[model samples]
Structure formats: C-alpha cells, structure tokens
Target chain A: AQRVTQPEKLLSVFKGAPVELKCNYSYSGSPELFWYVQYSRQRLQLLLRHISRESIKGFTADLNKGETSFHLKKPFAQEEDSAMYYCALMHDYKLSFGAGTTVTVRA
Target chain B: GAGVSQSPSNKVTEKGKDVELRCDPISGHTALYWYRQSLGQGLEFLIYFQGNSAPDKSGLPSDRFSAERTGGSVSTLTIQRTQQEDSAVYLCASSYNTGQPQHFGDGTRLSIL
Candidate 1:
C-alpha cells in the first residue's frame, strides 16, 4: 500500500519568514511526488512535482530518497500564501493525498 | 481547455434518500476519477475510469456506493440509502492518462441531513 504523511495539520509563519511543509511517503517503487495547494475558494492545483525539479511561486521541494521525504520549502512567505497544502503520492491511476497542512502567513 | 466539471454544486438531502453526482471530463481526457473530501479530512479515492476499461472501484467505502462512466465522457456517482455519514464534497477529476496530473472540479457539496 502507498501512503503519504504530512505530520503538520497547521503551520503558521510571519510574512517574509521561511516556511517548510514536511511530507514523507512510503512506496516500494520509484515514487512520484507532488505538492498541491488550494487557496480559499479555489480549485486544487499543482504547485510543484519532484520529477520536474522546478520552482513555482518561490517554492521548491527536493525528494530525499534516503530519508523517504519530499519537503516543500520557501525562503519567504507571503500573506497570500495562507492556504491548504496537500502532499500526494502517485500510484497507478490513483493519487493518495495527505491530510493537508493549513498554512497561515500572518502579516 | 475547460477542466473537469461537477454538477449540483451543493445538494442537501435527508437521510435514506439517494443522490446522484455528475462529472463532465475534459474534452480529450481518457481518465476520470471520483474522490470524496470529508469535513477536515483529506481526499479519499472513490473510483477511477480509464479509457474504455473497467473502472477500479476498490476505493469505494461500501456497497452503498456505485458509479458508472458513460461513453467515456460523463460519470455519475450514486449513493443508495444515504446516511449523514455520507456528507462530504464529492470531487471529480480527469487526466490525460494514468500517472498524469489531474484537473479537479469545484466539487458537489453533499449534505445529508
């Protein structure tokens, strides 16, 4: 069975402060990892994928195979960054999602 | 192109009643999936239809839940004799194929009263 775990249910940081949303997964095969964000009243959209190794909105996540982790990071947080972030694991046709971290960027 | 679209943005029904939620996939998407987002919970896989192949229904919570994809374009998830426990936002997503990024609809918020 494939599982994604986001240990934090909520993370708060002051504006301009660094933030990290930790995610870990357990999958036997080479894994595909993604971080998805849902802003208030908006559709869930892909933020970044580990395979792409690209940054979106100043956020990037590096998959660490040794640790079995893919943690999203940003040097600075913006007030608009307050949203629900979900970490997902792709398996076959299904993607198992974490419980999600509600990030609050306080000004 | 437009993303996945789900019908009846919000539905409130009494317990024991049956409810049907609809999904319209992207124009060229060959894979459609149904997921449930319960209050304060993560997305739960419900079912997936890929191309013309049989759907994977292993994620279904119980026999009370059933879904069908017609003509490889639209789908409807039916919950028989619904209970308050069935309350959740029913999300529909579609992808070009398996392992591809999925586009989701705003979802149908079903409140079983």
Candidate 2:
C-alpha cells in the first residue's frame, strides 16, 4: 500500500522566514509526489510536482528516493503563503494524500 | 469546460437520505478522481475512473458509497443511507492521464443532520 505522512499539522512562521513542510512516503515502487495548496475561499490547486521539478509561488519540493521523502520548502514565507498544504503519493493510478499541514505566515 | 466542474456546492440532508454528487471533468481528460475532505481526516481518496472502464472503488469506506462514470466524461457519486460520519466536502479532480497533475473542482460540501 502507498501511504503519505505529513508530520506537522500546523506550521507557523514569521514573514520572511524560511518554511519547510515535511512529507514522507512508503511505497514499494517508484513514487510520484505532488504538493497541493488550498487557500481560504479558494479551491485546491496544484503547487508543484516532483516530476516537473519546477517551483510554483517560490515553493519547491525535492523527492528523495533513499529517504522516501518529498519535503516542500520555500526560502521566505509570505502572508499569502498561509494555506493548507497536502502531500500526495500517486501509484497504480490512485493518489493517497497526507493529512495535510496548515501553514500560517504571520506578518 | 475550462476546469473540472462539480455541482451542488453545498448540500444539507437528514440522516438516512440518499445524496448524489456530480462531476464533469475537463474536455478531454480521461482520468477522474473522487476525494473526501473532512476536518479531521483531511483528504481521503474514494474512487477513480478512467474513461468508460470500471471504476477503482478501493478507497470507498463502505458499500453505501458508489460511483459511476458515463460517456467517459461525466461522473456521479452516490451515497445511500447517509450518516453523520459522512458529512464532509467532496472533491473531484481530473487529469489528462495516469501520471499527469490533476485539476480540482471547488468541491461539494455535504452536511448530514
């Protein structure tokens, strides 16, 4: 079974501070990881994907095969970055999502 | 449509009633997924449909939950004899294929009283 674990339920950071949301996965085969963000009054949107290797809204996540981790990171937190972040693992055409981490960037 | 569309943005129903949620994927998307989001559970996958093939209903919590996709485009999720535990925001997403990034709909908020 493929599983995704997001250790933090809430991450609070001051503006301009670095932010990292930890995510770990357990899967026997190759894993496809994705980061989805949901802001207040908005629908969930794709923030980034491991396969794309592109950063969205200054957020980037690197998939580490050895450690089985795909942690999302941002150099500096902004008030606009405050939202719910979910890590998802895709395998066999199904996606298993983590419990999600709520990020609050204080100004 | 420009994006995945889900109907009945909000629904309130009494326990034991049946509810149906609808989803319309992107114009040419072949893969559609149904997920449930609750306060404590966050997001849970319910089912997946690829074209007109049989859906993957492994994530469904019980036999009361069922889904069907027709004409390889529109899908409907049916919940029979709803319970309070079933209250949650049901989300639908679509992707071009198996490995592509999915686009999400606004979600249907279902409340069971």
Candidate 3:
C-alpha cells in the first residue's frame, strides 16, 4: 500500500516571491512521483515529474527517497501560478494522490 | 483524435437512477484510468485500464461502481442506484504506457439530486 500526504490545504504567497508545496509519500518500492496542477475551470495537467528532471514553466521538483518527499518549488511566483496542486505516487497498478494544496499568489 | 474526451460534461441525475460516463482516450493509447474529485478532495483513483486489464479495483467504493474499457481505446463508468453522496466530478485519463505521463479530460460533473 502507498500513501501521499500534502499537509497544507491552502497556501498564500505574494507575487514575485518564492513558493514551495510540500509533499510526502510512503512507499517501500521504487515509486514514481508526479506533480499535477489544475487551473480554474480547466482540466488537471501534469506540471512536472521527478523523473523528468526538467524545469517546467519555472517549476521544478526533486525526489528525496530518504525523506520520501517530492516538493514543488518555483523561484519566482506569478499571479497566474495560483491554482490547485496535487502530488501523486504511482504504486503498482494504482496512482495514489495527496489531499492537495490550493496556492494563491497575491499580486 | 486529440486529448482525452469525456461525454456529458455535466449530468444531473436523480437518486436511484443509473448513470453512465464515457471517456475517449487519446488514439493508440493502451492505458486508461478513472478518478473522482470531490469538494476539497484532490483526486481519488477509482480504476485503471492497461490494454483492457485493470489489476487495481480496490479504490472503488462499492459494487455499485463499475467500469469497462473496450477496443483498448474507449471506456465507460456506470453507477447504479446513484446516491447524493456519489455526486462528484468523474475524471478520465490515459497514457501510452503504465509509467507514462497521463493526459486528463475536463471531467464530467455528476449531481445526484
């Protein structure tokens, strides 16, 4: 069994400030981690994955196996970056998701 | 032909009625998935289809919930005797492989009154 936890339900930050969304997982095997984002009235899309190792739209995440953490980070937050973010773990045949965090960037 | 598409974008069904949600995955994709999103809840995995095989159905809440994927491209989820508690946004996703990044649809909002 695998589980994902995103402790904060809502996070608010000022525009141009740095932002980080915390995510932790519990898995024994080699697991795949991902960060998914959903904008207002839009479908959920893949923001970035740990395996990709690429900065997507200025956002990047590093997988920490020892701590079992995969936190999304952005150097400079923009007003348009405000949205719902979910962290997931692909375990076997199922993908378990975290409760999610609602990010609000105040301009 | 494009991204994953779900039919009946918004459905309002009465309690005790049956509802079916459809999903058309991207062309040539062999894997499909069904998920549910409720208020304040991120996304819950309901089922996954990998070339017509779903090894995980444990996420399904009850026997009233069922899903099937045929021809390895399209899928449908059926809920029998729907209850108000079942009202939520049903989402479908697909990928070329099990480990591939998934593409999602806008989802179908089901309201059981």
lDDT of 3 by residue, A53-85 (tens): 999999999999999999999999999999999
Best by TM-score: 1
Report DockQ per prediction, comma-separated. 0.82, 0.83, 0.75
Which pairs of residues clash in candidate 1, taking residues 3 or more apart in a chain or in different chains?
Answer: none
Instruction: Give candidate 1's iRMS in Å, 1 decimal.
Output: 0.9
The parts of candidate 2 lying over 4 Å away from their true place are: none
Candidate closer to the true structure by TM-score (higher is better), 2 or 3: 2
Best-first order by DockQ: 2, 1, 3
Q: Residue pairs in steric clash, candidate 3?
A: none
Which 10 consecutive residues of model 2 chain B have the lowest summed lDDT?
Answer: B49-58
Worst 10 residues of 3 chain A by lDDT: A88-97
Q: Rate the local accuracy (lDDT) of all candidates.
A: 0.94, 0.94, 0.91
- Give the TM-score of chain A, superposed on the true chain A, for all candidates in the order listed: 0.98, 0.98, 0.97
TM-score of 2: 0.96
